[model samples]
Target: MESQKGKWWKKAVVYQVYPASFKDSNGDGTGDIPGITSKLDYLHSLGIDVLWICPMYESPQIDLGYDISNFEDIHRPYGTLQDMQDLIDGCHERSMRIIIDLVINHTSELHQWFQESKASKDNDKRDWYIWRQAKYDDQGIRKPPNNWRSIFGGSAWTWDEATEEYYLHLFTPKQPDLNWENEAARRAIYASSMEFWLKRGVDGFRIDAVNMYSKPPSHPDAPITNPSMEFQWAETLYCNGPRMHEFLSEMNEVMSSYGEIMTVGELPHTPDRSEVLSYVSAAKKQMNMVFQFDVVCIGYGKDPKFDVVPHDWRLSELKKAVENTQGLIMGTDAWTTSFLENHDQGRSISRFASDKPENRVQAGKMLALMNATLSGTLFVYQGQEIGMVNMPQSWGIEEYKDIESKNFYEEVVKTSKGDSKALEKAKRGLQYLARDHARVPMCWDSSPQGGFSTSTDTWMRVHDLYDQINVADQEKDQSSVLSFWKTALKLRKEWASLLIYGDFELFDLEDEHCFVYAKRSDCNVALVVLNFTKKERDWKAPKEFNGKSFTLLTSTYSGDGKPGELRPYEGRLYVQV
Candidate 1:
């Protein structure tokens, strides 16, 4: 066992794999654990130290795998327990760690626990999930238990006629929020589900919607935000509620007994810096890292109500967010998980780059450079290295699998009396701007189905650019985006003292199109510069440092000159002499 002494996550790079779309070994048209096991060599070659596999627990496929039916068992579609063990062994053999998704915040209604809970009022498991009597007003009109609305665009309270009560579901009705206020419920969940993996030697857990574990004691109706909507649920009071830290600390203590395990919380709506720090601080005794959503807000403008359209994020704003989080963690015991794209986000290529093919590759490389150099643990979503773009515009509504996309399309396009063409155009914009764009299948080869499966059909449509953009092709090309990523990961690991745990300082340059930052460790100094716009731009090093010797580590442009000029979307990294 590794000693629990210092921050192990500081130099780690976690790769998130959406197993359902990773690969198919039995040609079942669905990615299974066996498929993931077969590809362990590929992930190992990519320099991945940790693999964060999304939920493969038993589910009915609602909300994909988020609606977990059995926390302790693997979903049949994914494979059996032996398959999971084989994957763990495979990863461990390569010195890689595995972090499974823990979705204890909710469970599928089909789960035995939930089934028993909703059976009767006096049932032993009746209080396992949130349930309350409907409210009655002076006029004798019945109302939902709370004004909270579901994240999937409906009332959070679903009427359960069998129990004569309303149950709470933050997301789809099939997934009812577990009653964390009940100690027995919490213990049962952690002991049964969490311990099952820990005892099996799984490295850690990436808790899903972790902050939503606790809710307000009094089920008050949420205030109205949209009058036209039938019900409105304000999430402020419920999300990140009080007692969250206490619950997390207890959970952490249980995990601590196992070994030097990693814990990452997926916290949403972390209000400001202080709240963010508290969740990740060493004193919190909760988690090693927390993935905050602040960086995802980059695409949105200053006005909160402004419509979301695909646009370029200013280099300064990106620098500020990175600096803010880095400053909070630096000199402290806490750490962060930095990423440009994940399963819940659109591919960074489509979100941050121009639609042109050439420009997308350049932008992808630059973004990879910027993200990999940040002072924190890095995460690379599947296909990010190959610069996968959004699904093509030709896809129709029927072809979409994401529930959120379908709901939004119906609300924004169909309700607005838009035609099919208008809806398709709106969907393209949404895909380019929304989170679903990143959930497409991993592009491994140019073969049919992108080499993900040999089946006649896939769970989700593979990106159309799979032919030109894939791991197999890029692995052979010296200048491919995939190669650049491999190099960047090697650089990070090789220069851990300077790149991983070094001090970060943002450089102030007159050009808004360029991003400049310096990493310093003792006497060693490295500067990273990125050109965000088209056309070349020349940047001058500090006047006093003009004579300093420099070594070019990597550059997107081929030729070199003093204070080099960057080509469109080009980026460079230099080590000071």
Candidate 2:
């Protein structure tokens, strides 16, 4: 039995706002912190229980907001610290909790700590970041400490002339990895980065790349997997280091010091189920829940994170991923995040189901039902509620502003030596699974700018289909995707005892076209069936559920619901009668 823990977050659904793309308050074209405040009523109507704003901290915006220059200060374009406070207060006024993004795994190279660390060999903060001396070959050629490729591509180390040593950067050279091994440095980071907001009335945090905190002490070269390239990918080489749990536990203790708090750690290249459970287990108190990547990563190829090559995903693969997660804490003291889209992933409608004009609405609602009925906290990305799809293929690579996608594209081009076939395949793969899909500007109206900004220029391009998919149009249609999402969320809350805390059991585990599951509580059993493809699928209750008749609670398709048949991309939630 999944523990019936009564945390407010467990009964809540989160709305993630990528501030720069959500909505623009001023005419500056870039979405600001105040922009988020201006739309509180809209979000409140969607029945979202929590608001999770991505990083908008003081930064140069190199990797958007992931590279923070100042932990506590707000970015100039984003707005003043007062704007953040207003957003926080606005959420509370509307009976919703707000959480800000926390990017502690790394910081901008221009950060004061990094500046000082590179100033001199004797600088007090020299050890605050991971730095290694150059290794000289027989011919006196300098080389990086290891052959570990940067997550985005190339060597992970960047040479620093001032320090005469190479600094480790898992991502872009500008974002240096913080050395968590420095106990004093870790304590100082916790106090400066998190305490400032917790002091103000901010509810909690959505920790970015939380699992990448620890680094291997030895920094050895990984086995060469990509022979075509000089460097290789080694996520196993860096994740879950010797001191990861200790660091998280200490961070958890500090979060607890503040009143009630919710923290979610993102494990990009997650380890095994038990390792993931250890991070969120109630006994450890590391986090409220963790976001697992398996469900989103089924199509990921050999070199998981860096490789965008797509694979044909089957219904069984989806079932396995969902069951693996549901089984992780079935009778234990752990919880996991339930979501289908986020800033780092593409839209769900484009991935799991057809995004064609004719089927988009049904596909969107079907995905929403899957997200809401899952046995953990629900997290709905900004445009996900309205069924936003991927960017058009007509858009060139230059239009993709996501650093990871652009980097991967460029790397493939260089590695494949500009082979036409390889480039075509790479582009197709990226179009299907790039991060930019989730970061695109929100579609709010039929206006040319999608009502996101007053200016013609946006930091990221707005979706072209905004004319037909904007919230302004959807809000008025009773059968729109937005309306269905509202109903789904409301029902999730109304059936919390069965949907949130209930035990999950997979039905017809080998089904190829549909996803079926049962959520059972002491007094109720709710069945959720989702058709993942365009063809209709049929399902019948197994022996255990034979005596029970199910009544349609809600459905993605309109009209009377049939007990055993599911239309193309149809979804129906039923309660045992």
lDDT (C-alpha, whole model) for all candidates: 0.80, 0.87
Give a tens-digit lDDT track for model 2, residues 369-430. Answer: 98888888889999999999999888888888878888887877887899998788778887
What TM-score goes with each of the models?
0.94, 0.97
Give per-residue CA lDDT, model 1, range 87-142, as digits (tens). Answer: 99899999999999988989999999999999889988888999999998899998
Clashes found in each candidate (C-alpha, N, C closer than 3 A): 2, 0
Worst 10 residues of 1 by lDDT: 300-309
Worst 10 residues of 2 by lDDT: 302-311
Task: Find the candidate with the highest TM-score and give its number.
Answer: 2
| Top lDDT hit | 2
Q: Which stretches of candidate 1 lie over 4 Å from their true place?
A: 1-6, 137-139, 227-230, 300-307, 417-425, 509-511, 542-544
